[model samples]
Target: MTDREKIQQILQGISKTALPAQPSESLFDAGVLDSFSLVDLVAGIEQAFGIKIPDSDLNPRQFDSIEYIEKYLSSHR
Candidate 1:
């Protein structure tokens, strides 16, 4: 699967709901994710992508949406 697909799958698992239609949509604003879910997302991303995410890079802005998460993963990888 593509990176975006993996992200969406991760998000779906965390949110336990359908993802927003827009890839750029803010998960926080859409009520799909919160501070607690962000932690789960980071763990999922790290495990799925096999990359370690440092605590210094754990900003919400870096993971606010699928597009952003893909970009972050690309850069980190």
Candidate 2:
């Protein structure tokens, strides 16, 4: 799958467990994800995409939104 598709899948996985509504543009700001979910997300990205998430890449900006995660992974991958 393309990077965007992978990202959407990742978002879907998260939404399945934690998010009450479909991910909108403001889901991140709406407290849809917390620290525990952030850790789970990083693990999911690493395993799904076969990419190592380095300490340098571990920032809230990268994890805050699905769009940000897609951009970051697309550039790095």
Candidate 3:
């Protein structure tokens, strides 16, 4: 799956809901994710992408949306 697709699936798995049709939608504002869910997202992304997300570098802005998360992963990878 593409990064966006993987992200959507991860978000859906974390939130137990459908993802927005638009990849730009804010998962946080849309209530699909929250602080607690962000934690799950981090773990999911790390495992799925095989990249380390240092706990000390946790930043909500890096994961505000699918676009942001994808970009962050690209840079990190």
Candidate 4:
């Protein structure tokens, strides 16, 4: 699967819900993710994408939505 698709699958596994309709939708605000799930999501991303997500860059804003995460990964990768 594509990276976005893989990310969605990972999110679904962590959140146990369908993904947001819009890429820019807030996963946290919408109850799709919480503090606990966010940690798992970050770790999941690191493992699934094989990219290092620095602890310093673990801002909630960066993980706010799929679009933001994709942008961050695209630029970094």
Candidate 5:
């Protein structure tokens, strides 16, 4: 599957709900993510993409949405 598809699957696993229609939609605002789940999201992304996310870069704004997550992965990887 594609990167976005992997992201969506990870999100679904964390949220246990349907993904938001808009890729740019805020996962936090949509109730798809919360403070606790953010850690799981980070772990999922790292495992799926095979990239280690530094603890210093654990800001929520950097991972607020699918678009943002994709951008982060592209830039970091």
Candidate 6:
């Protein structure tokens, strides 16, 4: 599957929230996600995308927005 689809799945699995059709949506800013949710999100992304999300890349910026996460996964893929 494509990165966007994988990301939507990851977000759905982690937050149990309906994912927006657009990829540029701000998951955190929109209150759809929060700091406590990052732990599950990180794990989901790592497993779903088949990419290792190192501790260094686990900062808020990386998870601040869906676009950011998608970009990171795209680079890794």
TM-score, cand. 1: 0.95
Clashing pairs in 4: none
Give the range where candidate 3 is weakest over 10 consecutive residues by summed lDDT. Answer: 16-25
Select the stronger candidate by lDDT from 1 and 4.
1
List TM-score per model, in order. Answer: 0.95, 0.73, 0.90, 0.93, 0.95, 0.81
- Which whole-number lDDT from 0 to 100 does residue 20 have in model 4? 87
Error of model 1, residue 12, in angstroms: 0.8
Model 1 alpha-carbon miss at residue 70, Å: 0.6
lDDT of each: 0.91, 0.71, 0.86, 0.89, 0.92, 0.76
State the weakest 10-residue window (summed lDDT) of model 6. Answer: 16-25
TM-score of 3: 0.90
The candidate maximizing lDDT is 5
Model 6: residues with Cα > 4 Å off, grouped in runs: none
Q: Name the runs in model 4 displaced over 4 angstroms.
A: none
Our tally of clashes for model 2 stands at 0
Q: After best superposition, candidate 1 residue 51: deviation in angstroms?
A: 0.4
Candidate 3 lDDT tens digits, 1-77: 99988888888888966676677888888888888899999999988988889877688988988998988888887
**Which residue pairs does candidate 3 place in steric collision?**
none
Q: Compared with the true structure, what per-residue lDDT tens digits does model 5 show for residues 1-77?
A: 98899999999988976678999999998889999999999999999999999999989998999999999998997
Q: Residue 16 in model 5: shift from native, Å?
A: 1.8
**Cα RMSD, each candidate:** 0.8, 3.0, 1.2, 0.9, 0.8, 1.7
